[model samples]
Target chain A: MADLIEISDPADPRLADYRDLRDVELRKSLESSEGLFLAEGEKVVRRAVAGGFEPRSFLMAPKWLDGLADTLATTDAPCYVMSEKAAEEVTGFHVHRGALASLKRRPLPSVESVLAGARSVLVLEDIVDHTNVGAIFRSGAALGFDAVLLAPRCADPLYRRSIKVAMGAVFALPWTRLPDWYEALPSLSAAGFTTVALTLADDAVDIERAVEGVDKVALVLGSEGHGISPRWQHASDRRAIIPMSAGIDSLNVAAATAVACYVTARR
Target chain B: MADLIEISDPADPRLADYRDLRDVELRKSLESSEGLFLAEGEKVVRRAVAGGFEPRSFLMAPKWLDGLADTLATTDAPCYVMSEKAAEEVTGFHVHRGALASLKRRPLPSVESVLAGARSVLVLEDIVDHTNVGAIFRSGAALGFDAVLLAPRCADPLYRRSIKVAMGAVFALPWTRLPDWYEALPSLSAAGFTTVALTLADDAVDIERAVEGVDKVALVLGSEGHGISPRWQHASDRRAIIPMSAGIDSLNVAAATAVACYVTARR
Candidate 1:
């Protein structure tokens, strides 16, 4: 069993990694600098560990210890038991999901490595919302897309809300940040993958038609605000759309991704 | 032109419908008792009006007035103009989108009325989350589904979060609560619509196969916690599954709806 320590004070030094979690910028910088990310709830934490992430430590309500004991035993990290009140105080929000773990962030895999031997992939360009990023990843993973490649400015998939919303699919999916924004699509094209960008560009064909018979496909999605950048859109081998009914302009980007991923998987 | 009245006090009775906007239970009861619902943001407000819901009143920051002036010109409802800070005070949250409107709720159409002459419909069972309910409505409308029929227990589509998340598709979609849950599926089946419930039951066929060649279809979805109840599942003509990748069990209910709607629309 993991060593169990009782923590009464929310200000303890050991809890520094979890402080002020609701401050997005602070959490981003702190997590990026500390080389760590958080996994909340028992299942996600378990998935993180199972996916080969090393845990730095764990915090949970006392009642949750037994439920997670077997998994905690596999790690050398200390598990801190605290009152739910104290846990909330440290996190700056209610910790209702029962358990949290701070796990070390591994250096991301290279785009080339993720793309290698991949049949279907999702390439995201500056999707601003963390939840959207996570949902897209979950869809890509669930629907048999082989990998995810993110643009330089896309929101981090490792953010806490993303982790929870994705139900830990982030851990299971192979994903990497594109090294160069200027040449991202071209590299995928050069790699012999058909790069299909989801857009409403007038020339865009129905997604079903666009993805048909492609040996290897990279389905590109853009941010909700501006959609695929002009440069990226221009570089794409083809443009495709979901073809919504009149009067409804667009689906939520995440919803669009799910639809596209599902169709692409079937194709 | 809407009578532009300036209200400086947050506690004014005219603003009561907009008060405590964040209190779910309070707003539920208040809106129910008063037969009113709110549409936030300028675009949603325009949709609510355009969708034929009569406006009870309009509330907006001064900056939003001109943008909505043409729409307001079509209504006799009073427009209450207030400072952004005062608007925040009355609403219990920041009114960042710059406008909100209270609209009179019409008596919902009957299940028979909604299903009449409709080819594709969605039947939701006890989906408790407002956001999920909204997203489903958005998906159904975008994919050319003619109407939606909800079990009595489904989340309110008019709820604020549903409206915002759905981008006001709730106003555009035709939906009504099923009067009798037990007979809902049977009635649709009798009305010449094939009832296909999305489930993970072992016998469920691939969704593509489940929806194939159906002229009139009623696509059923269930809640996050329990999925479709056994009664509803058994009553349906057939059960369909999304056929997810092995390691991942399922997509988010909303994402599943979009994917299913996409596939079903094509079928």
Candidate 2:
């Protein structure tokens, strides 16, 4: 069983990690410096633990403790029991999901290690939206993509919103940031993966044609605003478009990834 | 040239349709009652007009007026030019997008009309999230899905956020609310559609296999929470899932729609 601590004050030093969550800059700094990121809701908390992430601590109301009993039994980390009011005062939002846990972030696997033994992969270049990043990870993992490789500027998948939107897929997927933005596709090519970028280049073939019968594929998707950089676009072995109906410019990046991954998975 | 009105006061009654945008319930009430919805940002505003949505009025800063001159020349609607501060005061948020427009919403076409001459379609069931609805519309439009039929409770496609997320594809695509909740799939089947519910039933076929050679297909999708209603599930001609990897329950509804649309479109 986990040790239970009662905390009456929202500003208590023990509750420092949970404070000012709406302040993204402060939370980002605090989380990185302390090597901790939060997993909200009971399901996400359990998934974090089950996915092999070490919990630094947990915060919840008394009612929440029951649902997480199995999760608590497996860890020595103390579960901080506080009122819902206290949670809002600390977190700057409603604690509607009833539980939150701070977990130690593990070192990301290297690109080669994540891609090892993988037949299909997703390469996200500066997908800045946390929700989009999380949604892509969920689709990638669900469709059984082997791994995900992110550009250096891609939003952190372990960020609270990403973790929640990904429905814990971020915990299961093996992913790492590419060391060199320019050489990202070239390196994947060297490793025997065909880099098919989802773009609207004139030379682009339909997505179905691009992924057809490819043995190993890295589906490169760019950020929502500007698409893949010109260099990455040129480095790709093939350019593919989803063949949109006239008047619609493009799918949201996450939606594009889903379609691309689905086609490549079948291929 | 379009008529330009200088509105210095944020409380101008003419701008009531654009007020309290962040308040969902209030906006829904006003938009529906007035038969109007907002289109935000330059790109979305342009697409809305280009996509055939009639503008009731336009709001923009003086600098924004230059780029939209051609568009304004085509419409007789009054364009309200306001200072940035006045725009914020009226809308209850930063008007960083520079402009907003109140577009008259056309009467929703009947399901039969939306399905006219269309072989591939998407059916959304109670997808409550506006963003997901928009993303699905975008994917449907981009992937060449001919139409969309939403369950009666689905979020409004013309809702501002949905239009923004859809990049105005909602204006281009023909969609209507299914008149009957329980009979939604059965009605589609009666209309010569192969109603394929995207579900996790044990007997569900792979989406690619499910759509192969089907002349007319209606890919049915449910909401984030409770999926397809039991009635609709039972009513669909077949249940099809995207065949996710084990331990991953499902993709986000929008992502699921994207994959399903892509596969069905290729068929």
Candidate 3:
């Protein structure tokens, strides 16, 4: 059974992981990386527990503790029960959901491991927006994409905002970082994957026609402003574009990813 | 030629449309049904002008005015040429793109007119996020969705942030408010359209298999927290859901819209 501790003081050192969340908690410096990965709200916390991420500590209003009893019975972490007012003071903003948990970050799977036996994959190039990254993962997981591979510049999928925005899909979806994307491409191709680059260039085949025959496919998506670089474009097996009406630039990168993933995945 | 008016003072009455944009501009009630529709950057401003929403006025750095001279020749609106500093003060933020245009809100098309001859349509229910709404428009337009019908709770697509995020697709896409959604469904069915409601119910058919071979379709998407209301669920001709992994809840509304629109549109 979990250790239930009553916390009335907002300055408790054990509550440090949940403190000043809107500002310091969101920081991504090397020092803050030692801080716990925040799982906000009851739904995500329950998911984190289910995913085998043992909670170091939990802070929540007393009312919320009732709903979490079943999950808490199996955990050895200390659950810091606090008043909603005290909880708000420790955390910078109002946490309306009345619950939060901090878990230690675990080692991510390697690209090779995630890609093993995968038929369809999404390779993101420098997707900076956390929401877009999360949305892409949600869509990828939903549309039957086996794995997601992130290039160096992409936002961390484990980031708190990304995790929440992805509705816990990030926890279950297989993903890994490829520090050197160029070198990684050929290995993916050698593994029987057809590399499809998504771009707006004139010579690109219509996405509808591009995915008609390929069974094993890797869909490459680029950032909103600057698309996939010339090197990747040149190395791609085929370029596919979702046809648009004239005068429109392009769909949001995440939206485009969903369309591409849906089109390429087998129904 | 556009009348070139020089303004140095931030408090100038002529600059009212651009003042305190972070606060006043977002307040819909203050606009008195004649709210300013802002188009930022050179690209969106040009598109807005070409789309026939006459610019009421413009605040721009002198350097940008010279580049826009050819396009400005036909407009009668006064072009307020200001120093970069003054433009930033007037808008309450740095004018990074060096240009901004304020246009009067144009009348939205009637639902009947927007749906006329539409083979595929999207109905958005209570999606209040501006960026999500904007991305949905971009995806709908790109995927060849002929029209979008919005429920009353939907955000105004002409909001400034939405226009910027949408990259001006809002101006190009056909969207209108459906005041009477229940009443509109019979007409939609009468016009040979299959009303497909997207949900996560256990009995719902897979969206990919459900949409195939449908001639005319209306894909209905709901907000993030609450899925489609029971009213819509009961009214729909078919209930369909995008197949998702076991632990995942659902995709972002915009991402789901893209996937649904792509699957339902005439290929």
Candidate 4:
């Protein structure tokens, strides 16, 4: 069972991981370098625990400590119980969810390994927005995509805002960064995957027609401002466009990803 | 042609609608009053002009004024051309897109009128997030969903963030808030439409089956934290869920809306 430690001081050294989380520590560089990830709210924390992310420590309101007793029994991490005011002060914001867990970052598997057993995967190119990245992962996880492959310039999926928006699905989904995007495409093709680049280009086939009867597919999505890169357009085995209204160009990248995943996964 | 009116002062009363927009005019409340709606970027501004939204005025960088010569030829609104730095100071942020248009809010069409010529429509239930609201509209427009119907509590589709995130599709798609959600469902069903509610409940039918061969359908989406209300659940002609992984409960509402819209609008 985890040790329940009572913390009255906002400056306690043991609470360093959870301190200033809304400001200093919440910055992506700080959180990433410290190898710590935050799981906010009770539900996501519970999922994080279940996903094999061992909690390093927890900062919770005294009221929430008792409710988490059963889940805390499975881990040996210290649980710091504090007043809501003190917890909020220490965290640098109003902690509305009443509970938070800090877990050590697990090493990611290689891109090749994440794709090895996957039938459908998502390839994100230059998707810099954390919320969009998280939403993409959430959609990918929910829609049965086996893995998410991030190209260079994509936002860090482990960033705090990404994790919060993703509802902890970032921990559950298999994801990895590819060093060379164009190089990664041929390997996927060699592994019997069809590289389908999503674009708004005029000559591309409709997405419905492109995905028909495909067993294994990789759906490539791009940033909102720029669609897929010219390099990706050249490397793609096939190009498909989501059919849209005459005046509108395309959907948000994350929303577009969900449609692509759903359509391709349906087959 | 829009009259060129160069302004150097941030305190000018004429620029009040475009002043402190990030502060005084909350995106949600911007539509409640006679306040001007903001359209950012050249493309969105062009779309807004093309969609017949009468621009009250334009705040733009001097460089952008030259680029917008063709678009400005047909407009009668004043064009406040300023340096990029002055534009930034007036807008309280860097105007990266170099142009913005302020338009008077047009009266929304009646829900009946919006649905009159529609085949596939999206009914949003209290989706308050501007980004998600924008994203859904973008998806709806792209997927050829004929119109979008919002419940009372849903965010205004004309909100600046929604318009920007939607890449200005808020201007392209036909949308209006229904008089009441409960009353709208039955009327939709009476209008030869199949009312399909997207839910994650165990008893819900698969979305694939629910949308099969439907001529006209209303795809209902709920808010992020809460799924569709029980009232909506009860009123829906059919309940359907997107197939998802066991651990993940559902997709982000906007992403899910895209999937549902794509499924229901399949040719």
Candidate 5:
């Protein structure tokens, strides 16, 4: 069972993993350097443990201890209990759900392993928003997308905000970063997957028609501001557009992914 | 032509509309009481003016003046030119877009007016997040949904964050609050719409099947936390669900809205 240690001082060295939660750059560097990612809230923390992530430590208010007792019993990781105020001081934000876990991130699985039997996959290229990345994971997972392959530059799906926004979908869904961004689509095509790029190009066909009757589909999405890079756009087997109203900008990347995933899943 | 007034003081009364923008409660009350709404970024500012909203005033750095010169020439509203630092001090956040417009909020049109000749509509109930509301508007508009109807408690679409997230799609979309929440779905049904509630009820059919062959669809989505209320769920003509992977929670309301809109628009 996990040991419950009460911590009053927010400056304790043990609490370093949870400090400066609001500092994106700091957290990114800290998390990567330490090979750790944080899962916030009761549900997400529980999911992290259940998803087979080894917890380094946990932080929560005393009142929250009982709710997670069963989860704590499964791990020998130290659980630091503190007042809500102390947690806020350390995390630089209110711990509304009152629970957090810092878990070890395992080495990413090979792209080939994740795609072995997957019929539907999401390929993200430079989607830099953590929340957007998280939301897309949730949508793709819920819609039964088999796996996700992220370009080298895609936002970290394991970011704290991404974890919270995805409600731990990141843990449940199979995902790995692409080792080679340039050859990502062509390689998928060679692996018997029809790569469909979601773009606004004039030659783009309706999404419904793009993946219709296609087996082993790979749907590609782009960054927030500029869409899929010209290289990937040209390399993809098919270009699909989500038939939008005239003069209206495209849906937000997450929303577009949801719609695209739904269509691809159904197809 | 608009008057160009240079202001250095962040506490100036004329800049009240743009102050404390990060505080939701403060901005809501201030905007409502002053009969105004804020549009951030150069594009949103221009769209707000082009959407026929009367600008009460414009605030921007001197460097952004040339870009909006043509727009400012069209409005008689005062344009307050300030340094980027001064703009940040007044807004409580960095105004990276370098342009902000406080536009008059006109009285909302009747639900009947927005529904006239409308085939596809989105009805939101108690969706409190400004970003979600804005996203739904963008998705709804992009997918060719004719109108949006929000329950009385829904967040204001014209809120600065909402406008920015929606990319000013809120300005182009015809939306208004439903004065009567309890009778919302039934009222839409009475107006010849198939009130399809997006819920996870046991009886909920696939969204595509739920909206199939429906002439006029009023897709109902609930709040972020809970799905549609019991009353709204039962009052709707049919319950629809986006078929999700087993054991996964439903999509985010905005994502659900995007999928629903995409399906309904095609129907």
Candidate 6:
């Protein structure tokens, strides 16, 4: 069983992992360098442990301890209980769900391992918003997409915000960053997957037509500000558009990903 | 032509409309009581003006004036020019897009007028998040949904965050609050729309099959946390689900809206 320790001071060194949660730049570097990721809320905390991640520690208000008693029984990780105010001071934000876990991030598996026996996948290029990255993962997982591939510049799916927005879907999905960005689409095609890029290119066909009768499908999405880059767009096997109404700009990247994944799932 | 006024003081009363943009409660009451709404960035400002919203005033750094010169030339509203830092001090956040406008809020049209001759529509119930509301509008408009109807408790689409995330689609879309939330679905059905609620009920049909052969589709979605209320779910003509993976939870309300809109558009 986990040891429950009552801590009054927010500046305790044992609580270092939870500090500066709102500072994106600082948290990104700290998380990566420390080789750890945070899962916030009771559901995500339980999911993190259930996904086989070893917890370094947990922090929460005293009230949360009872609700998480069953989960706490499964691990020997130290649980630091504090007042909600103190927890907010340590984390730089209110702990809305009242529980958090700092878990070790294992080295990412190889791209081939993630794609093993997978038919439908999402290939995201430069989707740098953590929330968008999280949302896309949730959509892909929920709609039965088998795996995901992210470009080098894509935001980390394990970020606290991403994990929270994803509702722990990030932990459930198989994904890793592409080792080679330049030939990512070509490599997928070589592996016998037909890459359908979601873009507004002149030759783009309707989304349904692009994925029809494909044995293996890889749906490609780009960043928020721009659609797909010219290099990737041209290199993709099929370019698809969602056939939007005239005079409207494109859907939000996450929304587009959901639509694309839904269509590809049925295909 | 617009009159350009240079102001270095952040406390100027003329800038009241643009104050405390980050505080949701403060901004809501202030904006509603003042009978105005804010449009941030040069593009949204241009879109708001183009959408026929009268401008109460414009606030921006001097550098943005050149890019928005053509738009400013079309409005007689006073323009306040301040340094980026001073603008940040007034607005409580960095104005990344470098321009803002306070526009007059015209009374929302009746639900009947918004739905007049509309073949496809979206009905949102208690979707309180500005970002989600904005995203739903973006997806609905892009996918050719004719209008949007919101329950009385829904967040304001005219909020600045909503406008920014929607990419000014809120200005283009015809939307208004429903006077009667309890009978909304029945009322839509009476108006010849086939009310399709996106819920996870046990008997929910696949979204595609539910919308198949339907004319005048009114796609219904609920709030972020909960699915559709029991009343709305049972009252709708048909219940539909997106057919997600077995182990996964439901999609984010906005992502679900996007996918639902995509299917409904084709139907």
TM-score of each: 0.97, 0.95, 0.87, 0.88, 0.98, 0.98
Native-referenced DockQ of model 2: 0.81
Higher DockQ: candidate 1 or 2? 2
Interface RMSD of each: 0.9, 1.0, 1.6, 1.1, 0.5, 0.4
Candidate 5 lDDT, tens digit per residue, A136-179? 99999999998999999999999998988898899888899999
Determine which window of 10 residues in candidate 3 chain A has minimal summed lDDT: A24-33
The Cα local distance difference test for each model comes to: 0.92, 0.90, 0.82, 0.84, 0.92, 0.93
- Chain A superposition TM-score per model: 0.98, 0.98, 0.93, 0.93, 0.99, 0.99
Runs of candidate 3 exceeding 4 Å displacement = A1-26, A30-32, A71-96, A212-215, B1-15, B19-26, B32-34, B60-74, B78-98, B201-203, B208-215
Error of 4 at B109 (Å): 1.7
Model 5 misplacement above 4 A: none
In order, the candidates keep a fraction of the true contacts of: 0.79, 0.96, 0.84, 0.93, 0.95, 0.95
Ranking by DockQ: 6, 5, 2, 1, 4, 3
Evaluated against the true structure, the overall lDDT of model 5 is 0.92
* Candidate 2 residue-wise lDDT, B162-228, digit = tens: 9888888888888898888987787788889999999888888988899899999999998789998
Model 1, residue B39: distance off in Å is 0.9
Candidate 3 vs 5: which has more lDDT: 5
- Give the alpha carbon lDDT tens digit for every residue of A213-246 in model 4: 9988998888877888998887878899888767
Report chain B TM per candidate. 0.98, 0.97, 0.93, 0.95, 0.98, 0.99
* Quality class of the docking in candidate 5, CAPRI style: high
Using Cα atoms, each model's DockQ against the true complex is 0.78, 0.81, 0.65, 0.74, 0.93, 0.94
Task: Write the residue-wise lDDT of candidate 3 on B127-245 in tens digits.
Answer: 88888888888888877888888988888788777788778888887888888866666667777889888998777998877788888888888887798888887777888987666
Candidate 5 residue-wise lDDT at A229: 98
Error of 5 at A252 (Å): 1.2
A1-267 in candidate 6: lDDT tens per residue? 999999999999999999999999999999999999999999999998999999999999989988889889999999999999999999998889999999999999999999999999999999989999999999999999999999999899999999999999989999998999999999999999999999999999999999998989999999888878998999999999989999999899999999999988888
lDDT of 3 by residue, A1-267 (tens): 789999899999989888777663345552146745888888888888888887888899989988888878878999999999999999878897888988887777788799989989999888887888888888888878889999888887877778888777777778899867776667678888888999987789989788888888989888877988787777778899987666556778888888888778752
Residues B23-138 of candidate 5: C-alpha lDDT, one tens digit per residue: 99998899899999998888889999999999999999999999998899899999999999999999999888899999999999999998888888899998999999899999
Error of 6 at B19 (Å): 1.1
Better of 5 and 6 by lDDT: 6
Would candidate 2 be rated incorrect, acceptable, medium or high by CAPRI criteria?
A: high
Against the true structure, whose DockQ is highest?
Answer: 6
